[model samples]
Target: MSTTNKLLAGAAILVAAYAGSSWYVGKKAEAEINHQVNEINAAIATQLALSLGEGEIKLNVVDYDRGWFSSKVNYEIRIKSAKDEQFQFLAQDHLRHGPFPFAAIAKGHIAPLLAYSDAKLLPTKETQPLFDAAKGEEPLRAHSFISFGGATKTVIDLAAIDYRDEDGNQVLMAKSEGQVDYVRKGGKEQADFTMTFPSLSLVVDEGDLHVQLNGMRANGSITEQDKAQASEGELHIDQLGINVENSTQIFIENIKTASSYEVKDGLLDSTLTYDFGKILADKQDLGQMQLDVGVKRLDYVMLNQLSQVDDLDSMDEDELLPMIKQILVNKPEVYINNFMLSNPAGSSTLTSDVRFATTALDPVENEELDLGHYVESLNADIRLSRQMIKGYFSGENMISSMADMFFNSAAEEAQEAGLVEYDGNEAKLALSFDAATNKLLLNNKPISVEELVQILFSMQMGGGLF
Candidate 1:
């Protein structure tokens, strides 16, 4: 054959192969739509239950149109909260089947995928306000590429909002975007995502109230381990400010939060930390603060069941007692690993760890609960800088003066009574309790439970200290 003819034949063969594979993928994609929707619903429900305690989400396919190369699917999403409040929304998805979807190719994403989908929220009576806020643009849009290996990478965009009410109330949001990579295999699902929001503002003319947040970003990931789920995330804001007419104006800078949850061996552990780099109120600098807290060895099953309860308030003591006992049987530990605040004046720090005891009392045998017996141990340390305390209450206001006086009197009395140890510049308090030994110590000095209770009661009754 001539060279030109040979090249033409080769090109034709390649085109034929691509067309055949694309058609097959389109058929496969159509067949899997319902199954995928079910999977998505299950995942959403699980996530909602974990995060919100009690909620359900479902996605139902309303229409599907299949073609040789692409398909259109419409879905209705329904959400029900723990309060039984329901929200419904509609979305439309356009899917282009692979191996070489034209859209993906045009975007320079040519590695061969099962399909690529573009989905957008459709405006409805309930969502019309959101659409109007976005100036008639779709409030939410997502583009997803589904790999042949059952994984997906999706990019989500949130439209910028500029909304104002006749009453002079206004809300504005900058355009935000996020990406998610998700995969499910071997009966387990994993996902990673990141999101960024440049700014948000809320204003009300009634009180001259205004709140703003800027440079907010968050990233998170969730993975299944041994049939259980573990997740972690961090959120950071460059600055947050609030102002009201004739009221204190508050501003916080470089605020961050990190949290994690995990389950292992039928027990759950979680931790949360918050850090504030700078805080200012009414032009007064409050310095910085950090807090870290966590819980460990909680009965995962019991907690999960408790989280699923939609009406805890309706449950009587008789019904709730057993569930509480089940959770206590695991002997969970709660701790405040660090609570610190600092300024140029000085700093204060506190740490505490407390654990619950596994009780042998049965709900049937013991109708009345004795919470003291359920405490395994307690240990805490507190260190306060005298300078810091003084500086905090140094303002020339009636409240500050009264607070300073109260603290001075209390500190002197407490030190004299040996409940608090005062160093040159710092005051320290250490408390420990052991249930097995039936012992309680304050500042390393043994104190009977009765005496401690009496001391606290006396302090509350306006006594200096005991």
Candidate 2:
């Protein structure tokens, strides 16, 4: 062969070798990524079993394409971790391909979590099993890309991302060509919510949903079990924002707390403070008022707090029941403020304190006390003017019995004549409470504890009704 031909041949062979090596490197890198993903999937499954409950498991990656040329990667996932469980998320364009600020461009080098769950995407979320968290980037300075970028420079963005693990954990991600908006609408009949924002912002339309917890750590079995033991139904939102009245603009600010909540049988667990802003109904209308609430509990578990009070320790066993019952009736502090209710008799905006506590319950005789769980502070202010009771009570038979007892006692004692006419009439009473105690009120006169109890029972039995 000619020398010139030899040189040309060598160049051709080198080019082919380089192309083959590039292909081989890409294939190997993909295999390694899939292997790591599989490992991550397994860890997710174990946690799902522990957190959600036991169930069948499957993790499927529907599509995975990384375009180093485009500085982008795209993927999709479908997962079913337990019985009757399935969901999918799409993550795209995690890397910003266009020009950005220095910090944004530099942070883009590291991979961001490409997928996160939507509030309503998984209906059985309360029973959804847990998945172990994949390794993540550490916290950095407060910059636009700081939270979701890599530690080094030379960035690549994600085009689409999706993940589904055996533990029922699912995620989705996607990017837009320029800036795109996202809107979510949820609920049936009521049109529960309508929240929208740009492509990068997380949004929920309402219903039992939570979003923006892209960085929360998850562990423990995530298997779905009996509904009884499942976590409360709720939307778990870590960081999110919303926009009302469809428009061309988008805002993803006002991220809420590191909070979680549950709802069951129309009951709510007061775990998160999501409603912090003044809620506007539409163009120019106020819908909800400013409200700040603290320490709310359901089912008034008297036994939990009753055992902690100063006087309950000395109370005898038999005496405890009566005290507990009476305390619940008059002393328990279950309340709602800034609400208005109306009855057939009248209506009023409510403004008052209420209670079922030591000040309202009394013992007819001296007894040992053992109060271990008593609420020390309770107060609420209503935004409305008055509050009311809506239901009615029956007192016919009781009224007659009391009338007869009165006449009988008077005749037997001969302290009064046979009843000619009685002023007794049935009256129902609702109450508003106000007062504070101070053993340290060195100069203030204190109401006797016994007097307070006597007034409560007497008020309920009739003294203050009129």
Best by TM-score: 1
Query: lDDT (0-100) at residue 48 of candidate 2?
Result: 43
Q: TM-score of each candidate?
A: 0.88, 0.29
lDDT of 2 by residue, 287-365 (tens): 2222222223222234323423334446687867764664354343444433333333223333333344453344434
Per-residue C-alpha lDDT of model 1 across residues 1-466, encoded as one tens digit per residue: 9999999999999988888888899887776666677667755654554453676678999998887789999989887888899999999999999877889888779898889999999988778888999997779999988888768899999999998888999999999999998887887778889999999999999549999999999999887756676889999999999998859699999999998888777778899999999988887777899999999887777766776778778878887888778878888899999999987678999999999877734433454434356678999999877677666655556766676566667777677666678755677889898888878899888987777776766666767643
The per-model lDDT (C-alpha) reads 0.83, 0.32
| Candidate 2: C-alpha lDDT | 0.32
**C-alpha lDDT (0 to 100) for residue 210 of candidate 2:** 24
* Regions more than 4 Å wrong, model 2: 1-10, 35-58, 62-271, 276-284, 287-466
